[model samples]
Target chain A: MMSKIVRTMASFLILFVLIYGLYIIMHGHSTPGGGFQGGAVVASGVALLIVAFGSHSIHRSLLERRLSILISIGLLIFIGLAFGGMAKTFFYNFLVGSPIFGHIPPSGPNPGEMSSGGVIPIMDIGVGLNVAGGLSAILLVMALATTVMEVEE
Target chain B: MRKIAIAVSLSIFIGFLIATAFLIHPFGYPPSEMDDYIIENTQSETGANNAVTAVIFDYRGFDTLGEATILFTAVTGVVMLFRAKKKREK
Candidate 1:
């Protein structure tokens, strides 16, 4: 466990970290960051919590099984979206002209739109989920392993 | 003789690196024929303002899929390695 000050600070800071990460993920199609980067950001927050509270306490709520399931769900969403465009060709932007997320920006420089980018935004969310879950699970397991070693010692 | 050979090889490798660095394209001006096409058509075709995202998720999605798979495999390996010991102890 960390000092009380660190724990308190981490708890307070995780909310902003989560929101910023989600913003990056959601605006991936218009911004600089995307799924992997945003997901890494979210995982860093989890790392902060792990460092503050120790793995055992975090593990009680965020189990490896749950994380694994989250990873699976993300993979499924991503692959399903990919397959959805298979009729045209794999990874086709099938939603380009559709009513959903189908607004095309001007040819030149302009401000971006949220409901644009067809399947890109959805794929961003999926990859973000997968990356967040996978990274957090790895960190938690490693922390738990180290704790076990310390106990043994 | 061995020391001379190692020095010669190291210098040769360093020289090759320098030569390649000088010969490489100037920054931000890659010699890709597809760049113009992607830039011109990305907004209309993919409906995305960010060309990079359109390329990754739409044009070259297989790479992302493979990357996700690699991450999944890594997590599985890590969990399996540690979970077995924990189960045995309990």
Candidate 2:
């Protein structure tokens, strides 16, 4: 069993890393790291939990079915945004007129936003969710496959 | 028993080593010119900041559509393989 200090450190580290990674994803359009990188970091946090405890422990929180659903939902969000927006015009910027301070309006003609960048944030969020779900799915499935115990009858 | 354990572990380790050493590219390298072109062009067309997604979903949607079909084909192959294995085991 881990000592109190170690447990506290683990808890603190988990929160810090996950939130930091989320910050990276949120500011991805304006900053260095994007959705994939941030998403991988988020997965790393989940992996850290698996490494510290066992697989069944993590499963208590993020189940396999939930992870699969999240992945599908993320992909659907992106697809829905695409076709739904495309319905308006061929290559039309769906977020053209949205309001923002640092960036120009998203709807007009020019692309790239401080905020005017269009649906990139929504896309980033979708990709982030997709990746988080995917990584968790792989981890959860592997955990389930290996969670057997040998019994002597 | 130790010998059996060692041999099994060794073989699995060796398999992983071979796969990692050769299956993945020899070394990491910078993106090629084609990649650079897609990066600039897709971001331009899709108004999507992520050039990769733009290319996959918009710029070359047909290509991705074909790739998805190929993935479905592979899944079919895997199911067939599993059925054959079950039949043999039974």
Candidate 3:
């Protein structure tokens, strides 16, 4: 078992990391960070938690099965969004200037628009989910395998 | 003779590194006309304030798709490799 202080610090840090990552992903189309960076940050937070608490506790709480599902869902959302713009092109920017996420700004550096960038935000979300699940699964699988190997020995 | 050979190889490596450094363009001034075009047209085209994101998710979406495919494959491979452990645990 880990120390109480270590666990408490990890718990506190994880929340901030998650929120920052989500912010990066959400503001991807209007800021510096994008899906990959945000997802990596969030996955690192998960890694920190796992390291603090050990893999077994994490394994019981967050199943690999669920992560696989998340990866699949994220990929499906991306592909579906791509197909959504098939009427014009495969991955068309059809949503730009429409109601949804299609608010065109005045063609200069402005305040920022949440509902702009059309399909970019959706793609960012999909990619972010895919990366987070994939990376966390990799880390968990490695941890779980090592524990199993030790048990065998 | 061994020491001489190591010295020669190290000098050659250093020479190559120096040559590469000399060949590289000065910092902050990349000769990219495409960048100027993208910066100019990104707002109207994609409507996203961040041109980088616009390029990643819109202009070059195929690239993102390829990246997603690579991640999916990696995760699948890892899970498959560890499936035996899961079965054993069960």
Candidate 4:
């Protein structure tokens, strides 16, 4: 119906927003934003999407359950990466020329580029995912509770 | 009812803004120049080139741990507030 058209348009707009948000988050590591700022921007975009389109319209697409799982998974990955590094050389730049399991050297720039160098990029990705997942979990749980509240009345 | 709820929440949010304003000094503490040392050493020892990470996790570890505790508490509060909704629905 007409409502579906409106929702579909809104959905497309939200998708645009989310992509832009990711771009911002990715560049954020090197620029003004770090994990917290970039994460929050991406999270807010998700929240705005929820507001514009009903959960049923987008919930499955967002993978509510998987996102919750990913939240913990990201945390574990980050912590494991951290502690694992600690055990080796007391938190050595294990990600750098880390050789991807001691085989391949790190990404280019001859290992001299600070921003382009090792482990930092990996850490940024992990933090970005963690923020996105964590924020989504908060929204999911809140939404679940709110839906229940409506049912109770 | 929705309007009242919105108003109340807004007030609470505004109140927090006000409360925090007075908690810290406007003219902040002296520049410790402490971060400079951490930044230099972190590159060699910690291997973390990111200055913020070196300062937050390695140099000021105790504060970072405290922040983690704060995040835990905030999440716990949200869960508790919403917990009753599930039972009420059933």
Candidate 5:
């Protein structure tokens, strides 16, 4: 556990980090940041919480099983979306003309549209979830291992 | 003799690195026709304003799949290793 001030600050800051990360992931189709980058940002926030309140406490809430399930779901969503376009070809942008996320932006510089990018934003979300879960699981396990080592010592 | 050999190899490696650095294409100006095509048609074809995202998620999705698989395997391996350790302790 950390000082009460540190814990309070971490709890407060995590919300902003999470929102920023989601923004990056959702706007990936029209922005510089993408799934991997945004996921890393969110994982960093999880790391902050883990550091503020020891891994054991954090583990109680963010279980390994839950993270694994999250990863699996993300992977399934990504692959499912990919297969959705199999009628034309694998990984086709089938949603481009559909009602969902189907608006095509005018060519050249523009403000960009949220309802654009077809399957790209969805894929970004999937990949972001997968990355966030995987990285958090890794950090949690590593922290737990360190605590175990301390106990052994 | 070993020290002399190490020095020769290190010099040779450094020389190769320098040669490659000098010989490589200028920054951001590679001679590839595919880049032009992607840049021109990415908006129309993929409907993504970000060309980089379009390329990764659409033009080269198989590679992303491979990357995700690698991450999954790594996480599974780590979790299994730690779980086994915990079991041994109990």
Candidate 6:
């Protein structure tokens, strides 16, 4: 376990990092950042948490098995969205003028509506989830393996 | 002899890096017709305010697919490698 100061700082900052990361992912259709960058940011927060709380406790508390499931679900969401536009063509932006994420964006530079961007936002979400799960899983696995090696030694 | 060869290779590597840096296009002045076309048509074509997102999830979706595939493959490989092994009674 980390010191109280470290833990407190981590607990305080983790939420902000997570919220900022989600903001980046959700606003990806209008902002500079997108899914992968946001995901990495969130994963960095997770790494911070791991460092603060130690991996074993986190592993026990947070079901490590569910991470793989999350990864699968993310991939499914992405591929499913891709197939959702199959009526016209593969990855066709068919929802570009419909009710579901189909609000027409204003031409030229302007503050964009969240409801706009067709399937881009959804795809961003999918990629964000996939990256967050994959990166965190990799980090958790490495930490756990190192602990096990230490026990063996 | 070995010291001279190491110095020669290090200088060559630095020279290559310097040449590439000088040869690169000026900052913020990339000359590409494709970029202009994408920027002009992103909103109308894909209904996305962010051209980068439209490019990733619409214009170049196949590239995103490949990226997703690579991530999935990596996760699967890591899980398989570090999974717990059961012990057999002797």
Candidate No. with top TM-score: 5
Mind giving the per-residue lDDT tens digits that candidate 5 earns over B17-84?
Answer: 99998899988788989988999988888888899999999999999999999999999999999999
Q: How far out, in Å, is residue A61 in model 2?
A: 2.3
For residues A76-104, write the lDDT of model 3, one tens digit per residue: 98999999999999999889978866778
**Candidate 1: TM-score?**
0.92
How do all models score by TM-score?
0.92, 0.59, 0.87, 0.62, 0.94, 0.86
lDDT of 2 by residue, A67-142 (tens): 6677667666666666656767533446645454223323333444443246656656766777776676666555
> lDDT of each model, Cα atoms only?
0.92, 0.61, 0.90, 0.57, 0.92, 0.86
Worst 10 residues of 2 chain A by lDDT: A144-153
Where's the lowest-lDDT run of ten residues in candidate 5 chain A?
A106-115
lDDT of 3: 0.90
Going through the candidates in order, their DockQ values are: 0.79, 0.12, 0.70, 0.15, 0.79, 0.67
Residue A140's lDDT in candidate 2: 55
Residue pairs in steric clash, candidate 6? none
lDDT of 5 by residue, A32-100 (tens): 988998989999999999999999999999998999998999899999999999999999889997876
Can you tell me which runs of candidate 1 are displaced by over 4 Å? A112-115, B1-11, B88-90
What CAPRI class is candidate 4?
Answer: incorrect
Instruction: List candidate 5 stretches off by more than 4 Å.
Output: A112-115, B1-7
Tens-digit per-residue lDDT, B1-90, candidate 1:
999999999999999999999999988788987988898888888888889988889888999999999999999999999989889988
Query: How far does residue A105 in candidate 5 sit from its true spot (Å)?
Result: 1.1
For candidate 2, list the clashing residue pairs, or say none: A96-A106, A96-A107, A97-A107, A113-A117
Model 4 C-alpha lDDT per residue in residues B1-90, reported as the tens digit of each score: 999999999999999999988775675664656766764555554444456754544445345435444544465466566665556646
Error of 2 at A4 (Å): 5.7
What is the lDDT ranking, best to worst? Answer: 5, 1, 3, 6, 2, 4
